[model samples]
Target: MVATFGEVVYESSRAFADDEEEECEAQTGLSFEVEHTSVAKSLLEKGSPAAGLVFCAFVGKVAVGFGDGFVNNKSGFDLLAEVCMVGQGENVVDIYLNRPKKKVVAQLYYGAKDKNNPVIFALFNTHGVPRFLANEIVSKVTEFIEVSNRILIFHSDTLAYYQSDERCEGKVFYVASSKYSRANIPSTAVPLAPPNVIGGIGAGVLMHGEMMDKPALLLANYGENELVDSISLQPFAAIVKQGAPDPSSFSLSQIFKQLELTISQSLKSNVNPVAISNLYI
Candidate 1:
């Protein structure tokens, strides 16, 4: 049978958890496949695509993934987690990045471009995990997020970010958020926060991380909002300082400018009507 492109990428990431067939399937399920395919397709014009790959720890989220939130005030960090051709990168997947066969959703080489100066971040919403996988919805809280070094950085409310805990999902360490007022964030921007359960994917990832004794961080927006500014990327600034080889070399502003340009173009392409009333954002 000819495996679909989505299946190929899913399988690639799936390879990270080669043993636990049942548990793995239960966690990822068809839902993950659907989103996986949807995301892969979004990057393709029509056929198979895969340039190179290195299966590092995967950075993922269910719906409210970082692919959305942190609007307006942007992060000038010029380093963008540019998506790559990983859907059908057979040679890359089988050789370069996976020769050791480490179990992970995959991660960036951090400074692959210029290891000496290491500026660009090699990951983010890599067009495989859907922004809103069905199983991660509020109605599907029972299911746990799959195993792997999957970091959960989705959107959240200012309340949750400041509170340092999720109401339904249990106690969680609040990481960070975009700076914004209570009112809803901009359209292109996203109002972060798991739609439910302290964050559906967020909770699951935390649980899985605990089991591995390596809890992934939940870097999220300070509030459920979006934007057209550079402040949105402030939270990641902390990460840059921590993980980047040469922290000072980066600037959230550059990232904000790049995203701002791309997003502006995207916005112009769509037809969005203005809201007549603003009672509760």
Candidate 2:
């Protein structure tokens, strides 16, 4: 079934009691239900289109799954949970069991270079799970950008930098609002003059110099921090230095393969599966 933007859905918990077989069956058999919350709906309705749409599920205070995209749908939740389960360190039980108030399970951000650009999504974690999965995504995206013919760093709120490489003359190009100035560039990094033209979109885009085909990478950052965290950037740099997949096409399966994520169990399961590809947005 489909869901509107900001709608919340619930699935039966896998946890069950030893002596309550019938009760467990009843709980497991229950259909997913929408949770009605005025505040959540309001926030979603008012959220910026640039920020994309977010759908999240919580068991008490712990977020079990979350997804983000330009549009909202039920399948995104399943995708979120599938991605959440990909890595080691923290299992599902540990995530749900040790619920702390206001703790986030995962945060997914979807950004597009323009109406025509392919949508790109990034997932962030609050606790428990190691950052290997996030790192893998960053690595793949970084490789794409490095090999592309032209690189543009898109930003809405403030100026951000993409690490320079041989393809771009080891120089940084700016893509920010007209108000952007040299003062906005942080002191820790070498300051380059802002680009003459403000980027039309929020996510960074890489294009072939002659052919304006599909972008090599589309990137967006969401958080309180003014800059994209080093945790996400470091791995991307490491992978690019080691060399990465050629920038011919982008595929979710290829990324999963690169990360060594097993999909058989995820595919077979009804509750949590890789449903990101099915998303309309």
On the 0 to 100 scale, the lDDT of residue 254 in model 1 is 44
- Cα lDDT tens digits, model 2, 101-159, are 23333232222223112122222232222222222222332332222111123221111
Residue 180 miss distance in model 1 (angstroms):
33
Give candidate 2 misplaced runs (Cα > 4 Å): 1-128, 131-137, 145-147, 155-281
Model 1 TM-score relative to the real fold: 0.25
Tens digits of per-residue lDDT for model 1, 17-97? 224333334343332211223333222112122111111122232112233343543321222222221123211111011
Clashes of each: 38, 0
lDDT of 1: 0.25
In model 2, where is the ten-residue run with the lowest total lDDT? 53-62
Against the hidden reference, what TM-scores do the models get?
Answer: 0.25, 0.19
| Candidate 1: clashing residue pairs, number | 38
The best candidate in terms of lDDT: 1
Query: How big is the positional error of residue 96 in model 1, measured in Å on the Cα after superposition?
Result: 16
